[model samples]
Target chain A: MSGNSNATASGAIERLWKPLVARSRSKRALLLMAPLVIFELLIFVAPFLILLRISVSEAGERGTAYAEGTWSADAYANVLTSEVPREVIVHSFTIGLIATAIAVAVGLLYAYAIWRADGFTKSLLLFSVVLPLLTTLVVKTYAFRPLLSPTGTLNSLLESVGLLSTPLEIVPGLAGAIVGQVYIVLPYAVLAIYSVLATMDWQLVEAARDLGASRPRSVLEVVVPQAMPGIIVATVISFAWSVGSYAAPFLLGDDVTFAMRVEGQILRDFQWPTATALSVVMIAAMLVVISALVAVLSRFGGEVEYA
Target chain B: MRRESLETALFRAGYLVVFAFMLLPLAVVVVTSFGASGQIAFPPAEFSLTWYESFFDQTDWLRAFDNSLLVGLGTAVVATILGVTAAFGQEIDDGLVGRLLAPLVLLPMLIPPVIFGVTLLVYFTEFDLQGSYVSLILAHTLWATPLVYFVMRSVFRRFDWQQLDAAHDLGAGPVRSFVHVVLPNVKHGIFVGALLAFIVSLQEFVMALFLSNHTTETIPVVAWNQLRNSLSPMVSVVSTFLILISLGAILLAAAATNLNWLSKQLS
Candidate 1:
């Protein structure tokens, strides 16, 4: 229980002896990180590089082809200029943007409601928001497939309730894909915004109210501004997730988005070069969006300094 | 006050509608799993456990479930060990290298799963490691490690190093101090991280889609293929079981680690 022993033992051990131990500590840290770094390089970095190499190579007559000549940008050119790839890229971004926007709006509303509600209602709302994150992606897609099928529950409900004269064609289309993506990504947005909401200083709202601000005005001015960082984070994360997504679009979209197009090249046509190029484009777009988001958030004093 | 009340009512209604929308498809799947009819139908004409029985009757589903459990447990164990150690290393130094490597550690989670899947697929094929459980577990660990790392890092950041100092001053070795002081404090974090890693590995599909094969097919892959190839309520039944398992895991983790607070930290 002696203070001097503890301080000398701990402080001197870490700080005063730092020069002597720095090299070894760093080496040990590097050694600890070696497994994770090596695994990431092997599984994540190497494949992308391989894809980049393959993208530049020329396709052969029948089997897997590699160019005997130097690397060229032909695959990229094809990905950029080709009608299908271009359309797919544009469509994918469009869907991603729209889906992200809708999710943010819906999630913000849901979070706001839950934050404002009292007792059991708040927990119930939060639980519902968190439920989708627990379900398997494929199972969710399959569940939607039946529900959105032509003669499915949605259509039957519509007809039985006299809401529609005909069964709706809900599956195998952009609408179905957007719905599925939104449902899946909504929880992320809610969680993000709710975190910000939970940490926010509620005293500001009380101050605004004391100063004659209406509830709506106070929320609009104080709550929204305060939660901007979370909103931005949620929006960017949702957009990136939606863009790179393969399952919802592949299963629900009747071959509409860039993801579906890239999936086709890889899974159906075995066009590895074009698919790899598309994947590169998608990753680049995500990095740009994320960087921009980080920059904007930093400017607003909302840096995500994770502990 | 009138306007506020109206706005609150409207928002409440919107929340209910959206909540119902989110739960609808999942609920339909669970209900259809109990259908008397053989096909996938919502609002089943009659309720029975036929599909559940058939689901159990199929060996393929059982095998896939076993594979999923094995892979999930393996990934969780590996990722947790690596994550805790790496995070501890970071905490020990709190220097530039740790800062630099932090984001890289998060690469798996930040990058799209498709990119991760394709990358791993290409990497595995090059090494002739495709279809091996090792490759699948490695791929999964890439995703799982980040979650465990983040959880453990936060736990370590808030850790009281004074106790370790006390133990050290009392003639305890590094290993002993860690075992007695560090482990006790971060045990909840480790448990939560492991739970999360397990749940993620269990439900992951895209990477598994590209990597898993006949011998290593996971529950998600099996359910995906089955749902695509056939029209039956059996998949629904299996899906319900998976959902229940995931829910149980999440709740258990929450109970173990004050998950309501943990969820906020996770985001």
Candidate 2:
């Protein structure tokens, strides 16, 4: 009877200690996460807040300190009403749309090919796609300058072949910018779409074939629908990236896009208030695009099932 | 049978064309790097290593390379340490604090880097941290930590806690159990994350452009300035070197980790 009583007492102590141990474990976890949390707060969150505050203030005159008092909507008002600002926004969106569309269309086809190809072809294709992504953006941009220059490869080849009467100017323009942007972003689209393609069950294709569906019909009806979520994600991410991209446009676009305009205002002109306001607009636009993408995906994409 | 044959032929042709489209420009760059004329041209009249030699001769280029190496290595070490610890903490707690903090950690990657750069520029100037190597390292660390966190978080999720508990029950201390049991399990993830951080810091342009002074300009920033101020075939040499470095690192990392498995997981 005394031994039984001792056993019950030990069991009661064990039950009490278990919760304490779990709590301590969680406490240790929180301790681990603190550094990242603090770093983000100090660097990311704080600066963004500062930019937000600056965006509300009015721009000072050239070489004058920006007035720090009386927060107003003047900077935003200027961005909305100004021709340069409006055109920049439109140009940014247009470039983003065209680049994303091309990227997705090409990426979808590429991913499809990769999925059906032999092992060697699959590896080669995958490597080629990711190689550009691994390179520095500055390097890629500089490389594009030579390729797209009037006296560069494409024009030189055309002229040599007697196809062009004159050198075609390609670089330092919107065309060059779009081409460079597309090259940089295409890998992202391919990675996104290929992931979905790889996950799809080949049995579905076989089943459709048995049901008398053509290969193209099977892909359209079954494959495309299944891959829609990934496609949407790819489009959204590519668009967002294009919209905010500075390096390609700055190097290749020759001050043609909104991103370039923003950079110019901040870096060259030192118009902090104007740049801050433009930044806010860019973020708002991105948020809108993302929200719309989420809504559309939720409605039509269903749940993405990966194999 | 005819239809099947035709479909296969079409698919093969399409694949070849797509592959060319994807690789043609980069191939052009590599070929042009060997140009004898030391000018940007598509098909070279002659082949020589003159541009490559010129690249090596420039002192600024060498200094810029050194800067890139230092910044990249620094960011990798610091970010990986912080990211690993944070990932560990989040995994252990799985509490409200972890959930709330998770998105904040990821915000640097998700938000447009322009905003991040500008914000850092303002913040550093405010704190009088501008033009310092420490500031640049800190910025790059913030930029890289998210990638490390993502990698380590997944690693921790797959880790078996029971193993650690077993080690502890067998009379191992907490630190010993971590070093012997947990470290080995997560080593691949940590290595890959560190490699990625290194690569990112090496290639990063926008933030470095704003943050770095003349004395501390990284390879990318120096390249950007060179591109803007003067058109030089020497730029191609630098670009090619950067490409080679990144490719070497990626291949090395792939050899270290099961990249195929990791890519599958990311997908």
lDDT of 2 by residue, B1-267 (tens): 899899888878877886786777667667777888846777677889998878878899999999999999999999999889988888777776677776787656656677777778878988898878888899999878877888888889999999989999999997898899999999988998898889889988888988899989999899889888876667777877888887787677768775444443332
- DockQ for the candidates, in order: 0.54, 0.51
Model 2 pairs whose backbones collide:
none
lDDT (Cα atoms) of all candidates against the true structure: 0.79, 0.79
TM-score of each: 0.91, 0.90
Kindly report the fnat of each predicted structure, to 2 decimals. Answer: 0.58, 0.62
lDDT over C-alpha atoms for residue A175 of model 1: 88
Candidate closest to the true structure, highest TM-score = 1
CAPRI classification of candidate 1: medium
Model 1, residue A172: C-alpha shift (Å): 2.6
